[model samples]
Structure formats: C-alpha cells, structure tokens
Target: MLKEERYSVILDLINKKGILKVSDITDVIDVTEVTVRRDLQDLDQRGLLKRIHGGAQSTHPIKLEKELSHIEKKNLNLDSKIHIAKKIATTICDGDSIFLGPGTTIELVHDYLNVNNVKIVTNSIHVFNGFIDDPRYELILIGGSYRNKTGAFVGSIANDILSRINIDKAFIGVNAINDNTITNSNEDEGMIQTTILNNALEKYIVADSSKLNKRDFYQFYTLDKVTAIITDNNISPENIDKYSKYTKLYF
Candidate 1:
C-alpha cells in the first residue's frame, strides 16, 4: 500500500478504537512495525494524533470545525460512501426535487441516480459539478458565501433559498453521530443542514459507519427530525438497534 493510504487507515483506526499499539496497526495493515512507527510520528507532527509510549491516541474531541480541502476528504471513506450513495439512489424517482448537503458521501449519490426530469437543489459545488453537464436533471445551486475548502455555500443566502423551497426529500450529511443526536463541525454549515431538513417533507441523513457513535462540535438535528437514515452495511447491529428507535434505517 502507499504511505498516504496507510496514514489514512491508521488515523481511522485510532479514531475508532481511541488508542492502538504499533503491533496492532501493523497487523491490520500490510506494513511493518518500523513503518507504522514512522507513520505515527508523521501524523503526530501534523497534529492529527498524539504519539505515546507504544502506540497513539486521538488528540482531543474536535470542538471547532476544521475546514479540510475537498480533495482530501473525497479520498477518505470512499468505499463506504459509494455504498451509501447507491442505497440513497434507490429512493429517488422522476420529477423529484431533493436537497443534498455538502459532503463527499452525499456527492457520490449523484452517480447512482437513474431517474430523468429530476430537480436537485444543493449548496455544494462538488454536488453541482456531478450534474452540471447532464440535462436529465435540473440543478439549483444555492448561492451564498463560498467555503473554498469544502466547496460549499453557507451564510444567510443559502438558508434563505432553502426556506423558499419545499423539497420532496433532503439527503443531508453530517460529521458525527452521537446517540440519537446528529451533529456537524461548523455552526454555519449546521444551520444550512438544519434548515433544509425543516423545509423538506421527508429527510434522510446520509452518512457512513465512521460518522456513527461519535460527537462533533455543533449539534444540528436529532434522529427524530428525519424520516430515515441511509448508511453503509458496515454499521453494527448494536448501532442499528440504538438508532432504529429514533428513525427507520437503510443500507
């Protein structure tokens, strides 16, 4: 595997398990102990984690929103995102007006859409690009202050546009999911997501397994607000039971 791929997997493992030994990481990935230690050190220097005696741990609860480049995020959780997007596409129908929030997972939903004469409303430039050249769909790009890194529109303008329209469904993405509450990092981004949910007749929180059982900075909406959630098959049966109490779930 490439060095960067190893780094991403190691970071994901640390985040999920809280701490990991060098031997454990090497066992999971096809890398040696020497290489794992070096990778950990590199991630430590980048402030992604904290290196310790024999392993590494997460830095802290990310309370503040960190704007990462879209390119970087697009490469993370790719397989899970693709699976979730395919599941989401199964629900779309012709002549449907849907709201999609900004996230790499949500962006992939565009690929599996097979319907024609569909109208898509979104604040994500990445989401917009997927349908920009296709005439089968009508695209509505919500305008506002641009967040360059995320390629998303935020602020009052985006919210106002969302308020004026009533969508058939809203496929929202989130940074973290803790218990029954769904959250994101930035307050501005959270506001736009929340507003879209409020205006939609049906709301679907589209996320991957990595986002579950964790909490981010801003709590936008709870599971009760949505009609259902669409996640990847990797979600555990334990989580399915916990989240099912609040809303219907699909993979």
Candidate 2:
C-alpha cells in the first residue's frame, strides 16, 4: 500500500478500536515492526493519533473497539501482567476483602493469589474459574450478564452485587487513562466498575505500560478514585511523575 493509504488505514484502525497495539497494527498491515513504528510516528506527527510506547490510538474520547476474546488478551502482555500482578499480590492481607475487576491483567491477580483465608469477590467469570475451586481463598462471583468476548460479567446484576459488597481494596483494571480520568473499552462494564470503585475502601488499578494518556469509551472515575496504579516498567518515568501528583503510581 502507498504511504497515504497506509496512513488512512492506521487512522481507521485506531478509530474502530480504541487502542491499537504495535503488533495488532503490524499484523493488519503486513509490515515489519520497524515499518509499523514509522507509520505510527507519522500518524502522531499529523496529530491524527497519539503515539504510545507500543501502538497508536485515536485522539478522540476513547471508545471500545471490537473486543478481543479471552485467549487473545491473556497472552498479549504476559510478562508485564506478571510484574504488575506480583505487585498487587503483595498489597493484599490475609483477611482483607477484595474485589477484582474483569480484565486480563486483573485475572493475573487471581492466578497469583495463594494467601490463606482471603475473601475475593469479582464480576469476572475467568477470575472466578481461576480460583473458585481453591479452598484457600473464599471466591465469590458477582453474577451478571456474561460478555463472551471478554468472559466477564457486567451490567445491572454485576452493578447490584458490587453495591451490596464492601471491599478493602478493589483492583480495577483499565484500558487507558488521560490526565485525570480512567476509562475502559466497554461502556456497560465501565458502569459496573464504577460501582466497585465507589464501594471499596481503597481502589487499585492494574494496567500495563501502553495505556497511559489514552482514553476510551465511558470513564468510570478519575485518578482520585484509586489509591494507586500498578503498571509495567515500560511506562515513562515522566508520565509516572505526572500521574503521581494525583495518585500513587507503582511500577
């Protein structure tokens, strides 16, 4: 494809999908990672999209793109998720009540939780399945409509459940955050997440490096809503410093 055509395609990708990872663009455009990086640079220069560490996304109020299947997300950022997950694991106490969000990164929290006698509640079916059978943790699932693409429960039922439960710290997952806001790809899921955030004593958000400065459909809360955010090392120290003025940002 010509440079102009590729440019349009890149814009289209970001518009359709709230966030476009580097690999996702390369896969769609049949180009080298280096070539894709150049394309992203050009797009960012034109102010059509913002260049992230690993991808480009639209500059408009972020919206959910076509959601990915659970398997698709699980392996996308394995190492980064593991690092962020490990940090989150350390924050939990033996008897603390916690709520986990419906996100692949948040899924790692359940996978790594080996603590004895901890009560965990979630609207994530994958999270529930990961630990429901483990007798060491008291796993409670907030029943709601299942999103096949994400294997998460959201909507009214999930919102209702979150309202009734009290959690010490809720680990909310996010797709992107701008200066002051935390947003998600799915609108309905954002609604349920807001409920979880409102009820928790402390809320922690887990997202990898690529999500900073990006925005998506339906914001759940602002930076003040959470006590801290745990992200991968790839996030810029400059960005972390900017975010830290509002909330504790952990790498």
Candidate 3:
C-alpha cells in the first residue's frame, strides 16, 4: 500500500478502538516501526490523533457510548485484560462475597480465580458460563432481563436483587474513564453497575490502560467511590498522581 493508503487505514483503526499500538499498526499496514511513527506524527500534526509512547489515540478524550457485541470485545485488549485479571485473583480470599459486574475485563477475571469457597454475584452471562459447573465456587446469577447485545442481565429486577445482597468487594468495569469518573454506553448496564458499587464494602475498578483518560456516555461513579483501580502498567506516572489522591491505584 502507498503512504496515503496506510495513513487512512491507521486512522480508521484508531477511530474504531480509541487506541492502537505502533506494533499493531505496522503489522497491519505492512510497514516498519519508523514508517508507522512517521504516519502517526503526521496525523498528530494534522490534529487527527494523538501520538503516545508506543501507540496512537483519538485526539478527543471523551467518547460517546457505543454498543459493542461481546465477540467484538473478546479480543480487543485481551492481553492487558489477562494481566489485570491475574492480579485481581490474588486479592480475593476464601469465603468472601464478591460482585463481578458486566464487562469483558471482568469476564476474564473468572479464569484466574483459584480461591476456594468464594461466593460470586454477577449478571454477566459470560461469567456465569465460566463457572456454572465449577464446584469450588457458589455462584449467584443475578437474573432478570437479558440483553442480547451485551449478553448480560439488566433491568429493575437485577437491580433489586443486587440491593438485597451484601458484597465484600465489587469488581466493576467501565467503557471509559476520564478525569476520575467512570462511564458506560448503556444506561441500564451503567445503572446496574452503580447498584453493585453502592452495595459493596470495597470497590475495585478493573480496566485496561486503553480505557484510561477516555470518556463514555452516562457517567456512573467518580474515582473516590472506588477502593482501588486495577489496570495494566502501561498507565503513565502522571495519571497515577492525578488519581492516587482520590483512591488506591494498582497497575
């Protein structure tokens, strides 16, 4: 492909995912890191995108809510989610009641859970399937209405169920985070998450670094509401300082 063609493709990728690694762009555009960096620089100069340490991000910080299918999200930030999930597993102890909110990152957390005799409350179908047959966990499925788009339960019934249950820790996920506030695309999903956080004794927000410094529609909670944030180490030191004052941060 020509330089112009590669530029268009790179821009398109960033627009869809909000962030893209230089290595990821190079592999797709059949170019070297030097070439990708030049493309990103040109785009950055044109005010189309912002260049980061190893990737490019949308110039605009806030993103409107977009409904993404579960399959689409399954692979978007798989590695980062896996790393965050592994660390999250170590923090849970036996016989604790936890709430796993609906999100791709929270679903992955199920894979790393090894603690015995833990009670899990969740509305995510993916999380339900992950441990439906496991004997070690006592799973509580917060059933109500199912939304095929997100493959999760959401509605007043789900909300009421969560209100009655006490949560030791709530692992919540958001579509985006900006200026210490968490937001999501769907109001119903966001409302359910709000209830989970309110009912929990401790709240932990689990998201990949890509979700940081970005915003989605329907603001839910501020960083001060959470106990700590669990994410990948790709987060910048500047951000750590900005958010650490409000809540504990774990990268």
Q: Work out the TM-score per prediction.
A: 0.74, 0.73, 0.74
For model 3, the stretches where C-alpha displacement exceeds 4 angstroms are 1-61
Q: Model 3 — which ten-residue stretch has the worst lDDT?
A: 58-67
Q: Where is model 2 poorest over a 10-residue stretch in terms of lDDT?
A: 60-69
Query: lDDT of all predictions, in order shown?
Result: 0.86, 0.83, 0.85
Q: Global lDDT for candidate 3?
A: 0.85
lDDT of 2 by residue, 1-251 (tens): 88888888888778756677999888988889998899889888888899987887789734444456778888988899999998899899899999887778877776676688888898888888888778888888887788887777888877876788888999988888777778887888888888888889998988887888777767788997689988988889789887998898888
Instruction: Identify the candidate with maximal lDDT.
Output: 1
Runs in model 2 with CA error above 4 Å? 1-66
lDDT of candidate 3 over 135-157, digit per residue (tens):
99999899989988777899999
Q: What's the C-alpha lDDT at position 17 in model 1? A: 55
Error of 3 at 105 (Å): 1.7
- lDDT per residue for candidate 1 within 163-244, as digits (tens), equals 8899998999887876667877788999999888999998999878877877777889999878998999999999999889
User: What range of 10 consecutive residues in model 1 has the weakest lDDT sum?
Assistant: 60-69
- Name the TM-score of candidate 3: 0.74
